[model samples]
Structure formats: C-alpha cells, structure tokens
Target chain A: MTRALYQFLLWLHPPFFRQRFGEEMLWIYDESAATHGVLALFTDGLASLARQWVMRAGTWKLAVAGAGGLLEILMAGFFVMGPAPTAHVAATQSIEDPAQFSGTWKGSLRSRPIELVLAKEGTVWRGEIHFQSPDGALRSAPLEDIRVAGDSVHLRVQVDDSDMTFSGKLVPGTLGSRLVGALQATADASDDLISYSTLQAFHA
Target chain B: MREDLSPLVPLSPAILHILTALAGEERHGYGIMQEVARQSEGQYKLGPGTLYDNLQKLLEHAVVEECSRRSAADNPRRSAGDDPRRRYYRLTAFGRRVLLAEVARLEGVVRHARLRLQTNNPRRAS
Candidate 1:
C-alpha cells in the first residue's frame, strides 16, 4: 500500500519534474518508508494537491472551489443543527373522521399536475405525492409528518431540492367539489418561503 | 505595493525543514528527508510527496535551485553502485533570510510559551 501510494503521489507531480526527480523521489520514499509510513504519505499527498489547487487554479476556479467547500459545510451544518420547524399554518384539532380524507385526489400547482394519495392509519393520516419535477422528471415522494386536523390538513415533502409544506382545507362536499389551500417552499435556514403557491385539489 | 518584501515569510514546516537542511550544504532529495527527520528528533518527518512538492514551490520561488554536480561521497544515502542522476538542492540568499526570520519568529513563540509554562507551575517559578 505504501509503495502504491508513493507511486500515486509521484504521478501527481508535473511531467517535467517527474522526469527530472522521479527516481530520487522514489529513493527518498524507500529510505524514509519506515518513518513516514503509508498514512503520512496519504496525508501529504492530499496536502500537496490542496496547495497545488490553491496556487495553480485560476481565479474563477478558486472562487468556485471556495463556494463549493462553504456550501458543503453549510449543508452539513444545516442537517446537524437544522432549523426548528416553523408552523406554516395555524394548528387545529385532529380530524374527527380522518377516513373521509382517504383516497386519491388530483391537484395542480404552478401549472404542474400533482397527485396526492392519502390514507388514514387509525387517528393519523399518511400520504404519497407524485409530481413532475422542474426538469420534467416524474417524481413520487412520500409525504411525511402528515397531520389532518378537522377541516385543515398539512403534510411535507421534498421537491426541487427544497422542503415543501402543503397545508389546505378539506371541505366535505359533493364528489366534484374543490379543496383549496396554500403551499410553502423553503430552500434554506431562514424558513422564509422561496415560493408560495395556491393549491387546489379535486377528487380524480 | 511592498514589492521588496519577501513572500516566503510564513513558510510551511516542510519548506522550512528543506531550507534548513540545504542551508549548510547542497543535498539530494533523500538527504533532505533524512536530515529533516533527524533535526526534528523523529517527531516531524516529511514524506516524499510533501518534500518534492515543496521543492517544486521553492524552485519556482527562486528560494532554492537545483544543482547538477553530484558526488556519491557527499550523500550517504546514495550508494557507489546507485544511479548517478541524483539532483542536489541548495538554498539561495533569499531563502537564508526567510529561514532566519521564520526561526526568529518561532523562537519568540517558544520563549513566550516557556515563560507561561514556568509561571503557571509554582515549583518551576521558584
């Protein structure tokens, strides 16, 4: 493993340097293998690459790398120390008959057709949602943290790389009646809505 | 702009070690590695990747340049039967100044740390 890592590190050098000093580098590796070992070699290889990137990369590429590294840290921190769930809608009492909300309902938001399949599990509501993504890819996302309270129903799903919370009123009426509500899509920690759209559902 | 100011002040350990090893005499790559390990008492060692990469940087910075005159007797790591393509490196004048400045900075840091340690320890304070 040490020999292989040493060869890999040597290969990272530019061709001209490799041609000039490759043999001497190998000799050094052989002499210092006992002291440096494989782990140190691997760490040095990474450090060498990072230094090369910082020194050699163009301004644009350096900016992109900086942004990418920052984004990764922010994303990891977001998950580890996620924002408290801000209630997108006022809480209401749990539905007396959650079973009435069960069955498939069709809706549209921003001109995109959406399908919602709701089911009652004892006192709670469970659902699955299907919609066409922005890239025109059909995505079926399981709705989570579903709560059905009286005439108000709320559920959350991940869409378009954003957390989308859909809260609407389920009015018991004729079979062809309309269910109306609003959708809140948040993309980051601020919990501010990136996009808010009205949602209308009809039994399909 | 401070154009005359040296850009190598905040030298990395690997670069500093390489410069220190070559300060007294010109040595090959392996020679630098062995000397650095010996100088640090085996506590800090530079792997071949790190050593060569910093050597490239130092060459670009003109702080150190390659020398072609190779004598196997000069480097104990090179055997009599070994290939004679050993590349030797020596620190330029600029590198010497940088090394001195960095060493002084390190000395100040070490002195302060030692003083604090002794002051905190009542037995040592006496």
Candidate 2:
C-alpha cells in the first residue's frame, strides 16, 4: 500500500515541478529510476513535490486529481495559511552575516532591546534583541531585515504581528555609533517600544 | 482524537534530509541539494526531481518554508555573470523542534542496535 501511494505521488509530481526546475528534472527522474528501482523513483518524486509545495505553494491548483484529490485540496489550504508572520520572517531572513552586524547600538523603545551583529559575509546582518516590560516580562526576537546604506544603517525588527523599522545614523569616531532617528511599526499599532542609551560597536 | 493521528508518520529519509538542510538557513532547490550532499558527505545525492519532491512533502508538513524568490545571482552554482531568481528555504521553529525529535527517535534505534550487537559479541564491545 505504501509503495502504491508512493507511486501515485510520483505520478503527481512531474507536472508540478517541471514548471519550475525546467526539463532537466525529467531526465533525472529517468536516470534515478534506471538505477534505484521504484523506491528511488518515489524518493525523487516526494522530494520534488516537497520542493514545489515549499517554494511554489502560491501557484498550487486545487483541481481534483484522484483519490488523493481531497488530500491535495486540504494540503493546499494549509500551505497557504500555515506559518504566520513569524515563520515568514524567519524563513525569509535566515541568511545573515553576523560579522557585519556585530556592534551595539542604542535605540529608544521601552519594550525592546536593540543589538545588531554583522558577520564576515559582508552583506548580511543579524540583530539580537531583548524585550522587557514594566511588569518584568521578557521576550526576544531576531531582527533579520538589516540594510547598510553609506553611513546609515536600517534595521527591521518583527515583534509579534508587527514589524518595526529603525533608521539610525552611524556616528563616526574611534568607534562606530548609531543615533536613532525614527521607529515605526509596519502594520498594526502596539505599545511595545525600544530605546537605546548610546550605540556602540561590539566585537563578536 | 485517535483518528486525528498524523496521516504521514515516519517521514522518508529524503524528507528528513530536506528538513535538516533548512534547519539552519533558508536555501533554494539547488542550495538544498548542495547542503544535503554536504551533510551526508556526498553519501546522499538528490537529483533535481527528488530534491523538489521531498521539498514538497516538507512544505506540506510545514517543516520547510520558502524564504524568497531568487535571481540567477542568488544561485551559487550559477556562473557569476548569470542571474536568475531562485527560491530560498528555512526551517520553521516547529520544523526544527520536530527534526530534533526525529533525530532523537533515530538515535534510540541506533542505541538499541548497538546494545544488541554488544550483547551478541562481547569482544566487539571492548
């Protein structure tokens, strides 16, 4: 039964994945089938289907295909809606070079802590933060949307359902300093805030 | 509630590999292939078809996430001058937690096997 189900998934995959990976994948399927038998074929098929669903769920079509049609439809709905904003931000901004952002910057938000680390890759930055409220509750979020422009650095921090964009000027001296300009949330208003004393670069 | 049991349990090795690749960072299809190869030290080579198929299953499980659209420039395997958009992937916290659990489960099997082997061959244990 598992083998049959595997075969069925394989049959469902080519049309779905070929649209993105081009014709090369079809040849791969043929080659894998020649060597690894039905198991390899099924593995290949399942992998392709997994890739499509992850990368191209936005393009999925829900037309009934067979006994699995209902499953497909249900999966489509889950794919479209699962992974709320937090998941989206993490997945989208997972690539950050910690060297570039390895500095301490101060901002003024009473609720959130602001610390950025720039790593060796030279292009990406990861911001680590801590949030503390008056009631003494603590929370933390990783800031992935970091952009460096000339002497200015921009950091986007997502807290819960809202995204806050912070623009700061890099102060030049023996050490790098950042002065916060304005902090605004992208969507939905929340009382959670961030504040800094003096932004300082820290060696990671 | 019992019927609510997972429809798909005991995910395939390919699916596990795909999930493990995304656990640290987001990767595109080829990126995933490369990472999986690296992780297994080339023991597991996933062709494009197989890579994408496993990706779909992980996506269905919400264990893998699509990070973004990639241009040719984003593809490390592409020539430096060639630019095309390629999607990136990352493991959700849920995905990471689940993968860790799966790893523990697999480790349990290995531990049991080792115990059996040791019992069967006392010299091997030494």
Candidate 3:
C-alpha cells in the first residue's frame, strides 16, 4: 500500500537521517497523512531523500553499505510497480468551503502588479503574494493573518519591515470569481485604500 | 571590530524562518515546521528536507545546536508534554545577532529604496 511505498522512500534516505528522524517521519505520516494528502506526503518524502543525498555530497558517507544492492532491487521494483496513486485533496479541497479564497488573483496595487496564490490545508490557509518589480523581476512574500467575514477578506504581506494589508471583498456570483478592494500599506498610513479590482483568471 | 555579518546578510528565506522559529523557543522538526507556518500565518511552509538540510548547515556553522533533554531541562519554558525521543534545536547567541543584523540591513535597504522612490516621483511623496 501507500505505507510500504513511503517506507521504501524513507529507506532510500541516508542512514544518518534514517537513524535520527526515521520514527518521527513515520509518526508524522501516521498523524497528518489524511490532512496533508497522500501526494504531498510522498512529495515530502522525495524532497527529504534528495536533501540527504545532496548534503552528504563530499563525505565518505556517500558510499553507503548495501546501497548498490538496494538500488538494483529498487530499479527492478520500479519496473514492476504501476503508476503511483495520487490524492490531490489539497487542490480539490481548496475549491471547497473555506478555501473558496483559493486561486491566483492578479491586479495592481499602487500601480504595481501583484499576484496572490491561496490554498487551504487542514484548517490552515497558506499562500504567497508575488509583486513584479519595475525591472520585470518579481519579489514575493507569504500572506499572513488571513481573516474572512461574510464576502469580505483581509490579508497581510510583509515587505521588509513594512506591512501591507489588503482589505477586500469577493464580487458575489459564486465563490471568488472576482475580488475588489484596496491595499493600504502601513508604511504610508496617510495614503488612502485606493480602489482596485483583481481578476482571478489564473485559476478557475 | 564591525563583527562583519556582511558575509551572512541577506539570508535565504528558509534559513531566516528556521532561525526565527528557533528564536521563540527550542523545538523538534515538526514543531519548527508548525511554528514557521503559524508565525507567517500559514503562508510559509518548510518541507522536511528543507528544514533538516538547512538545519544541518546551521548546526555545522554553530548558529544552531542540538539541545538534548538535559539541555532543554534548563529552559524553564519547555513543556513537560514534549516527546523525549524527538530531537530539539535552538538558535545560538551568534544566530540571534545574525538575525538582528539581517533585519537591520533590510530596514536600511527599504528606507533607501523609499527615498529613491519619492525622489523619482515627487508627486508620490507622502
């Protein structure tokens, strides 16, 4: 089952890591697998494997005992196993309930283009906001203190030491088809919450 | 001596979050992940690999250190309910200084950028 595959992934990690965090990783899998979804869990496992290998790059520890035999068996196993099961609960669930805020909302704040990506996991809502600089590069930040009331939404993004709070509401029809509001940054409190609308065209 | 943190200024976001989380209190791997997510209001998430590898480097650099149960016992705030088997880490004094320096450096950059912005667009001045 998924448990065996996860265990196999864990086994591929360097021994030093397996010795340190093997049980804790398994414990987390047991506790949050249902919440984080199967796909995210496997992705996390793969990330851990890559990290351990990369960090041990220069050490003699790279020559792990039994790794040669293990790799041969794994390649054979990969040929035998079919496509991996995927649970996209994070994507699908974000469309339901509280995650109605989920999507890519693109617009301009004070004439600067910004993009916000929102998703919900378990009860926690997490996402990032990317602001395109004048040079065409983008500097992004994570959204914080997300509060929703009726159709109104409020979120904050920290830019260095300053905080910009976006106070807006979803244009009603169904879900967050459109969002209109003003983003007032704390750095310029004297400024108004200049009117604007951000289209959620990136994600349906 | 300037105690040059120029070499460490502009830390990667991952390292910054990890250091900030440990600054609040010592924590295990899961605790650190949860703390970063909670601190940033669920916006920033650290995967197991990202957490440990950066943590390993921080440990190697001595900015972060493993805090065994006996070491954690000295910390009055550590809860009794914490699992004894889980390893905990905390930011060292040097790490705190580095974080503060980074913050200060960022503030200066923001300030300088703001001044330039106002100078470029006189009407936007506030």
The numbered model that scores best in DockQ is 1
How large is the i-RMS for each model, in angstroms? 23.8, 15.0, 17.8
Residue A19, candidate 2: alpha-carbon lDDT = 39
lDDT of 3 by residue, A126-151 (tens): 88988865467788889998876555
lDDT of 3: 0.67
Q: Output per-candidate TM-scores for chain A, rounded to 2 decimals.
A: 0.47, 0.38, 0.42
- Model 1 clash pairs are none
lDDT by residue for model 1 over A59-173, one digit each (tens)?
A: 2444655566666666767786754332222122223355657888887654568889988877677889988765688889889898886556788987546787877666444
Ranking of candidates on DockQ, top first: 1, 2, 3
Clashes of each: 0, 47, 0
Better of 2 and 3 by DockQ: 2
A1-204 in candidate 2: lDDT tens per residue? 644565456556544344334433444444345544657656656765765554443223222223244554566677876633222333333232323345655442422344454432445565666546446676677767777654456777777776776654433335543343344456544433322112233332
lDDT-based ranking, best first? 1, 3, 2
The parts of candidate 1 lying over 4 Å away from their true place are A1-5, A57-204, B1-6, B70-80, B110-126
What is the model-wide C-alpha lDDT for candidate 2? Answer: 0.54
Candidate 3 per-residue lDDT, tens place, B16-57, comes to 999999888888778888888889998887766667767766
Models ranked on TM-score? 3, 1, 2
Q: What does the lDDT come to for candidate 1?
A: 0.68
Error of 3 at B107 (Å): 1.2
Q: Which residue window of length 10 is worst by lDDT in model 3 chain B?
A: B60-69
In terms of lDDT, the best-performing candidate is: 1
